[model samples]
Structure formats: C-alpha cells, structure tokens
Target: MARNRYSFLVKLPTAIALIAAADQLFLGTAIGSWIGALALGWILALLLSRPALRRRPSLVALAVAAGFTGVLAHAPSLLGWVLFWSALSIAALMPRIGRFDDAWRWGLRLLAHAMTGPLAPLLDGIRLFRARPRRGRPSSSGLAALLVLPLAMTGLFLALFASANPLIARGLTQVSLPSSFSVIFWALVLLVVWPSLRPTRWATRIVARMPSADIELPGLPQATLLLSLILFNAVFALQNGLDLAFLWSGAALPEGVTLADYAHRGAYPLIATALLAGLFVLVALKPGSASAANPAIRRLVVLWVAQNLLLVASSILRTLDYVEAYSLTGFRIAALAWMGLVAIGLVLICWRMLAGRSAAWLINANALMAALALGAASVVDLDASAAAWNVRHAREVGGRGVELDLCYLSWTGPSSLLSLIELERRPLPPRFRDRVRYVRAEVLETLVRRQADWRSWTWRNQRRLDTARRLLGANPPAPAATWPGTHRECDGWIRDDPAPEPAPSVTSESDPVANAVATTTPPLTGTPSR
Candidate 1:
C-alpha cells in the first residue's frame, strides 16, 4: 500500500494544522473560551479548505462533525469533550481518505496515525535542515573551540566574582523568566511545528502486518451456533413475553416489585445482552460461513434478532414509564438514547446477516448514524429539555409523578427557572407555590450576577440568562432559605417541617436483623447534580 506523498496537501491535515495553531496561541486568555475557540478554529479550517477538499463528505457527515463540535462548544461537559475529539478525528480523516471501509482495522490505523501525525514533520524538518549546505557561513568548528576554553574560564571567574560580591551577583541574577513569556514561547513553538506531522501510511502498514485469528477458530461449530440460537431465542422470548404481559399490558407486578424498579433493573442489562448478541452474530456468522449459508440457521438468527428488537422496545417503554413515575433525568434520558441506538444496531446486524454485508459496512453505517444523532443533539440544550420535561410532567402539573423537587431543580441550575416559573402559575398549596417563586427568583438573580462578570460569559449561559431576565424581570429574587426548610423536596420545592420519623418497631429480642439495624448508622443524603 504505497500511499501518495501529495496526500499531505489534503484539507484534513490543513484543518488540523490550523486548529493546532489556534489552540496553542489563543486558548488561555479566557479559560472559558477554550471550547469556543477550538470549535471556531475547526469550522474555520473546514471552511478555509472547502475549495480544496477533494472528497466532499456527505451532508450527514458534515452535520455529525458540526453537531459534535456545537454541543462540545456549548456545554463543555465530559461527554462533550469526548465527542469533540472524536468528531475532530472523523472529520480530519473522512475528507482525505474517504469513508473507512474496515471498521476494526481502520480504527486501530486511525489511532496510531493521530499519535504519529504531529511528530513525523518535526523529525523531517530536523533532517532537512541538517543536510542543507551553508555556502559562505563560517564552519563553527573553530568558533566552538575558541568559545570552549574562554566559556569555562568566564564561568570560573564569574563564580569567584559572585562569591566575593554577593550584592552584585544577586542584582545580576534577579532578572527571571516571565510567566507570560513561557506561555507564549511554548504556544509559538507548537504553532510552528504542528504543520509537519502529516498523515502517512505507517499506521496502515503496521496494522496490516499484525496477525489475525480469523482462521484459527472454526467459527462456533454450526451445531453449536444452532443450539445457541435456539436457547438464546427461548430465553429472550421468556423475558420479552413477561415484559409485554406485565409491563405493556399494565398487569400488577408481584408483591414488592414496583414497575419503576423492574424497568430500571432490566433496561441497561438487556442492552448489554443485545450488544453481546450482536457480537456473537458478527463472530459466529462470518460472511460465507456454513452457518450463515444454512437457511434454517439464518432464520433462527433473524428470529433471535427480532426478539432482541422487541426487548429493546420494551426497555424503552419501561424507561419512559419510569421517567413518568419518577421524573426526567439526564442519565435516564441518555440511557433511553443508548437503548434506542442498540435497537438500531440490532436491526443493522440482522440486515448484515441477511444481505451478506461485511462487518466493515455495518460499522461505517452505524458510525454515520451516531455522528448524525450527536450533531443534531448539539444544536439544542439537552439540560433545558430535561428540566422542562421534568417540570411539565411533575405531580404539580397534574401528572402522577412526584411534585417539583425544588432542590433538584436548583441542582439543574438556571435551566429549570422557566419551568419553575410555569409551575408557580399553577395552583399549588401556598407553601409549595411560594417555594417555586423563591427558587426561580434566586436562580435568576444568580444568573444575572454571574453574567455581569466578564470572565463567566458563555453563549449558552448568556442566552439562557437573557431569557431568564426577560421572563422574571429585573427585581432581585428573595433568598431560598426565606421559604423555611433546610432541605428541599424539589429544586425549588421545600418543606416547612422536617420529615416524619419512622414508627417504633416491635421485634424479637433475639433478631439479628433488628440488632444490625439498631447498630447501623444511616447513610448520608443529598441531591445529585442533574
């Protein structure tokens, strides 16, 4: 695989080079500007090399990159950081090499390429400079000899002089390196050196040279594949049937089982099961395997995938029902999204098996889908969405869920203000209503104060703050503590009195459980960050 040297002229590296320069130079003036500065740099690089981009990515690909960058720029959360780098990676490569055809292999190749990308050019520059002839410049061999003896003698004399004249030495050594100069020097060096780390075939060749065990395992024996499929299908059938009966049909659960608890228990684990099933399919049903060629085995595999899809759907409904019973949350929302993705992946797997598509094709297709979803999410504020859903579906809003957890809303930060304001309009007990007003007012005031500071400005916060002010007006909000309780039931909803104490229990004197309970200290409590 002799790759072209001119590949360095592609837009991907150009975009990267520009980003490396900008991030190195302009990132630290305002710490908050880091994501925005980097995002702007990426978008600029893309736009700058638009004319030169040889293989224009599909609009979907571009959207994925944009969404990944947009959300990261807006939120700056941990997820955002991961997506930001991943987006940069896919974008930087896609336009030059085109879509990756081998999923597992290409992924390894891309990783190594990124590590080596920046280092290769620096070494090349050193080599090129070393080989260049200086026609008229002095050899420096004589210069080095002339300086060696004198430099050592000067250092010796300076050391003796410094010891003799302490004040003079202190004055001479007082001039130290400036902190700002150190920052600029490193940034400048990176900016100058980054353009040299051009992408090469080194990673690709190395990955190709690596051994594979594809031929070693005779793929799960056909008899084993069939038996495994039958057993898996039966097990999945039982779970899916139970879900359809008890959950979807609204039948009562066994004593001690809440629907929310049941849903929570199965949601993530079922997703894992589906993922494992997909993996099994990829490995056991290699493209032209005897099992894949058997129509009966293919049918069984298809049936199993269908069962997995049903399980995924049940998991989704279970999550939604749980959210309705409790309240919406970021984790629950993400879990739902992930479950949906797994469901889609299962469908893709079935298609791959039926249509004779390679695992690579399946991978590329899923990657494209993931990229798009992320990009679309980036355009909206997910926290605000969660806050609004939770507030609207809350018991205060005639939903069968818990009433607005004011403390929880506070943990949601200012994103819950509008929802809190809406809840305030509802006819709540005077105490609950007052708490809502108090909390929203407090959050808005905090936002206004923070926004007033030059250092704390962010587009998302600024936009939300402006909306918060417009909705709540300029009056300063009252302190949340003014509502009475130290603890809160919701972000804005507080209790006037402490929680009711548990009833005294009558237990056997010899009961070990009772003894343990008596000795055990209660665990600590506080609201989680939303």
Candidate 2:
C-alpha cells in the first residue's frame, strides 16, 4: 500500500477528534461544545482536501462564511443544528466533485472517504516487518530494548508502590492497569479501536477527478411517455381536486373534523408525494425523448406539473393554518422552506424537460438552489424567530392563536428572551397566567445572569439580551402575582422593592410598534404584591 505521510498527519487527529466528540459517554452532550469540536474537524477536512483556498475565492468564502454561521449561531437551533452539520460535510466535498452535484451522491462519497483509514496502521506494521533483516530471529539489541523497557517500567511502578511517600502509594493502589495477557481485550481493540484511530484522505484530485465514461441512453419510448404522463396527471388531478375543494375553498370536512386535524395530516405527506412526482416526471419525460418532443405530451406534462405546484400550495396553506393554532418551531420553519424548495424544484424539472437541458445542467441548478437555501437558513436564528412569532400570535395578544405553550417556550432558551418579556407583559387568564409568569421569570433570569466568560458570548444572544434589558429597564415589569390555591415553588417573583409608578408619557422612538405595550386589566384578585 502506498503511504501518504502528510495525509496521515491530517487524518489521524481529525478521525480521533470527530469520533471523540460523537462519543457522548465520554464527552457528555453539550450541543455548543459538540458543534464547536466538529467545526475544528471541518477546518481540518477543508485544508486537507483543498489547500488552495486562497486562490479559490468561492471555496474560501463558502468555508469561512459557513464557519461563521455554524459557530456563531444562537446557541443550537433547529435550523442552525441541521445547517451546521450539513455545511461541514458539503464544504469538505464540494471542491472535490464537480461532475454530479447531488447531495445524496456526495454523502455516499464522503462515507467512502471514511473507509481508507481502517487498514492504514496495519499497512505500517507490515512495512516495518518487511524492512527488517532476513534473520527469522529479532536483533539482539532491539530485543533487549523491548524487554528492558517493560522490566524498567515494572521496577519503577513497584518501587513507587513500596515507597514511603503516601501520595504515591494511594495513587498506585487506586489505578487499575489493564491485564497484559488479555487476549480478548486486544482482539476487540484490533477489530474496533484501530479503525477509528485511522483517518482517510478526501481522495478528490486522485480518484474523484477521473471522469466516468458515458453510455448513450435510448430515448424513452413514445407510448411509455404518453401513458406515464396520462396516469400521473390523473392521479395528481384527483389529489389536487380534493385539496382545492377542502383546503383552498374552505369547504367543510366530513363531520367531527377539526381544521387543525385536516391541515396537520396532509402537510408533510403531500410534500413527499410532490417530490416523488417531480422525480417521476424527470425520468418519464427525459429531455430529447420522443414523448418530450411531442407537443401534445408536453402540454399534458405542463398541466400535470401545474397540478403538482398546486399540491405544493395546498401543503403550505395546511402548514400555515396548522401553525396558527399550534406555535412556530425550528422544524416548522425548515418544513416551510423545504416545501418552497420542492415547488421550485418542480418548476426547474419542467424547465429542463422543455428546454432539453443536459443532465449536468439540471444537477448543478438544483445544487445551486439547495446551497442558496441552506446558506440563508444558516444565518437566521430560528429559535428567536419562532419565539417572536409564538409570543406575538398568542391568544392573550391581539393575534388569532393558541393558548401560550409556556413549557416549550422555556425550552427554546435565551433566544426567546424578548418574546418571554412580551409574554410577561401580556395579561393572561388565571390558569396559564402563572405558568407564563414562572416561565418568563425563569427565562429572564437565565438571560441576565452573570457571564460565565467571553466564550459564552454570541451576537444573537447578546442582541436579544440587550433588547430584553432595554425593554425591562424602560418599564419595570409588575411583580408576579399568585392567585389563591396556587403554590409557589421557587418564588421567582421576589423583588427588593416595588416597581416605580410610570409618568404619563416619556420621549422615545417614534416607531409605533417599538413604543407599543399591551394594556391588560388584572382580573384575578391575588395576594398583595411582596
């Protein structure tokens, strides 16, 4: 086996670091720290795969920009979490493969990159054995060195154990050294431990650069194309018609049907069906096929694709209606963006089939579209966005929405600081009011707590805390009041003194929204404020 010294240097640490970070038992599960570790591995992978980032402006920007987005994300959000891992893998592989831009194929190629590391250490062992002299017996001096070293270690350890020093005696007694003759342990280590220790070179310029020879694919038959399009259009029409009548026009569902049930059930599955339809269209109506050339079939394909687009529209409406009753979330935002991409992809598929674009063109176009979407998602702090939407649309607020989900809102962490502030200011009904107060207080204290260090600082967190602070400072929030029969766990509303009475009006920004505060009458006669 050919040895790559430089590659060995890069791969070993990278493999160890990645595997170690993923080993939750040892590292524990801290998302920020875990992602931070992966970020280092990403940089190593990029430098290993493409050393010439300076000369490659686009590559440099892609790497550096991705680094910022992943690292400085508002802690770890739903969108930020996915984008963070994906951006790392894509950054490592994009510069290597230019032929097929499919992410699925690239992911497979990345897995293949991982395989090369396994036998590397074994190769070194074999090479060393072969380089030795022709004698079957080992050299006297080398044999002595090996034997003497272990004996020396044993003597030193035994001396320390028997030493008068109490610290050394206790340290040696507490440590359990592995058995030297543990064949089972050695077997397990060789079979498992060794592979992960090795790292693979991202073989782009070598194996990846070689172009695969192409075979001429016969055009899809005329009959098959027409028949497939006819069948697909019929199927799509049925689905779309149902969606139009019930979803778009707000026709009643069968008895006992709620809007949320109707909307939630269809949102995800329809997107998947639309994606499959797009794939079928690509295959059945490949460019230059006899069916594609037929004007009548082309028209039918357009009609069918239009129906699929409508299906996408229905899915969006379904999700939006669902969100109105439910609250916004990271996955929900991603799902919305994903449905949009599917819609855009269907349009692109139509364009390709009509324009007779090459396969390469379709792949690259789709890849570019995906890259743009991911890049946009990376910078957006989804936790903050979701929190803001949920708080603004809460039933207590003026917007049409569900009762506040205080438990979930709390889990969103400091990104929801401003929204928690807004929730605190709103007058909630007695049942949810106390929970909201508790959640808001918990959220507020966490955000304003003493800094652990500069390492914990992030732009999203900083900006949000600043905004929450300014709002709190402008008007000291009312103390959390408890209704009769409500138990106080931690008494989060404890204050040094009562809030100051506000003057009639004060000079502030002219912005209506910024100056706005919801007026709420206290309905619950609670115990006097502390």
Residue pairs in candidate 2 whose N, alpha carbon or C atoms collide under 3 angstroms: none
* Per-residue lDDT value at 276 in model 1: 93
Residues 362-426 of candidate 1 have per-residue lDDT tens digits of 88778767756665565556667888887777776687777656677787776776777777767
Q: Lowest-scoring 10 consecutive residues by lDDT in candidate 1?
A: 1-10
User: What residue runs in model 1 are displaced by over 4 Å at the alpha carbon?
Assistant: 1-34, 42-81, 90-103, 114-176, 180-204, 208-217, 254-261, 476-530
- Local lDDT at 199 for model 1: 39
Write candidate 2's Cα lDDT for 339-439 as tens digits: 99899999999999999986667766787888788767766767678889988887777779886676677787676767777776677666455566677
For model 2, give the 10-residue run with minimal summed lDDT: 24-33
TM-score for candidate 2: 0.68
Give the Å shift of residue 399 in candidate 1.
1.7
